[model samples]
Target: MQPIDPHSPGVMPSGLHASVVDQMGLAIGAGEWAAGSVMRIEELEERYGVSRSVIREVLRVLASMGMVESRRRVGVQVLPATEWNLYDRQVIRWRLASPGRVAQLRSLTELRTAVEPQAARLAALRAPVADASELMGLAGKLWAAGQDGDTELFLALDIQFHRLVLSSSGNEMFGKLNSLVAEVLTGRTHYSLMPEHPHDEALQLHVDVASAIQRRNPVDAHHSMLAIMERAMTEMSTLWDEAAHK
Candidate 1:
């Protein structure tokens, strides 16, 4: 997805510990450190040019995310990718950064396809009036940004629009996926996966979804959102094929 802004409020703190975590995470994700490969704490400390405590903390964080497991005598072993906490934002970011970026994007988009339409439907039925109004406003801004070829603004607005829809769904579980949606939208834009200028139809579909929610039309909202997801899949498929052939 999108590049995580280093200065962003909740981003990983900057320091040796974070650097070690990121480097090791990226290495593991890129298959440089294959699953089942082991690295001792002293080795990690030396590789990262950090101290034992920093290395230990990095492993602790990675272990919590299911990226690595530390054994009593075997050291830290990289786990299989299938065992990772896929929902963890850092893991998602690392995967997007790896050679598997395209596949990661495809998987996340598929997830959005499955989840967001229903979220839209629930938002149409349950969103507060204020939130519905805000979504409508964001939709209008998205259209403007898209038409103007303002990719940066469009990306931000698109993320916000989807995040609001998810949050307004009145399902706590759905609300928790805001980061997932943000990563998808961000990744699409940052990785050149999105168009220089968003398609007119895509912009209009966003408007349609917002309008349906504003009107409390659940059926229209569901279908409109589904249409959006279908278009994304089509666009991504074409781009992915082109990239593969290149």
Candidate 2:
């Protein structure tokens, strides 16, 4: 696995413990440590040239993420993927960084497809006037950012735009997913999967979604949002294919 970049903003700076976590997370996610495989803390400490204390800390972090469990007599055992906190931002990032990145993106895209259109419809039906207005204004800013080729500004605005929609839906479950959605958007840009110029149609669809919500037209809002996800799926698939071949 490629080492996480130390200079990358938002990435954890590498240290004995951080490095161990990243390596072990990748190893487990990539199936290097199969489910139910037990690993001794003493062995890990010696293998990584770290103290038992550091190794224990790393295990604790992994356990919190539902990746492993400590048995009374047996060593730490890897958990099944179903047990993982897959929605945790750090877990999502680590999965994206691992070899199963294409599969991870595919799963996330399907999840977005299922949830976001409904979120858009709910926003149309439930958003207050001010919240609807905010969506429209954010849509304008996102379009301008894209047209100007402002990558950083566009990405930030894009994340905020979707986050606003999910929150405006007035559904607590949707609101909780804001960070996961942000991670997906950021992942595309971070992986160099984004086009140099944002797709013109996709930008227009954002405007359409905002307008539909502002008009309280749930049908249009749902369709427009679905269009956006459909386009993204196509783009992501193409990028994944290109990356796999390369």
Candidate 3:
């Protein structure tokens, strides 16, 4: 998925409001405005060249996400990372764009590993026939994209494939995590963390998952999905290590 540009047309707050929110969110995530830092409305308005109303709106958005707390005399106090709504899409986007991106990726991947394999297994048992067929089609497209080195197409398809699996798992809670999966997949590609040409093993494992789900083989689906998560962890570790050494 594409990053939500503040200038772009959509559901997000437009123009200056969106820009201010994004900038402030990034700063908070980066620890530029550390927890306990107080941001006065007048100061923020002056800094961003916006009005009091705009600054208050931005603060409201941030406060809803647990990023800040507003008080009468103290202005807006930045909250600790522990207080932030980590699952909020905007929060996830900011964190991914921050300096601590690797840690965010690691945490997201671990969460996926814990949740998706069971989702795949449950999907094998409960997915509708049409959904299973669609997964199979997505898996094939993913293979072609990976083989052709089509990173953009691969990322989109990968997100769709995983999201479908989660939604088809007959569990609403798992379905809600689709956005989290999408953000992490997008972050990986955006940061050049993913290989340009995807691994053949990884491509085949996706196929294995779809095929097993289609065949109603829960065991195979579970194992194949687990393998995919394991492979991702190994790849990320290797890449992080290489980057660190350099």
Q: How much lDDT does each candidate structure score?
A: 0.91, 0.89, 0.94
TM-score of each: 0.93, 0.87, 0.93
In model 1, which runs have C-alpha deviations exceeding 4 angstroms? Answer: 1-14
User: Which candidate number maximizes lDDT?
Assistant: 3
lDDT per residue (tens digit) for residues 69-180 in model 1: 9887888899999999999999999999899999999999999999999999999999999999999999999999999988888889998999999999999999999998
lDDT tens digits, residue span 1-246, model 2:
997785454443457578898888988888888999999887887777776767888899999999999998988999998999999998898888877777888888899999999999999999999989999999999999999999999999999999989998999999999999998888888877788878899999999999999999999999999999999999988887887799
Question: Which window of ten consecutive residues has the lowest lDDT sum in model 3?
Answer: 5-14
Candidate 3: stretches off by over 4 Å: 1-14
Between candidates 2 and 3, which one is better according to lDDT?
A: 3
Worst 10-residue lDDT window, candidate 2: 6-15
Write one digit per residue (lDDT tens) for candidate 3, span 89-170: 9999999999999999999999999999999999999999999999999999999999988889999999999999999999
Q: What is the lDDT of candidate 3?
A: 0.94
The TM-score measured for candidate 2 stands at 0.87
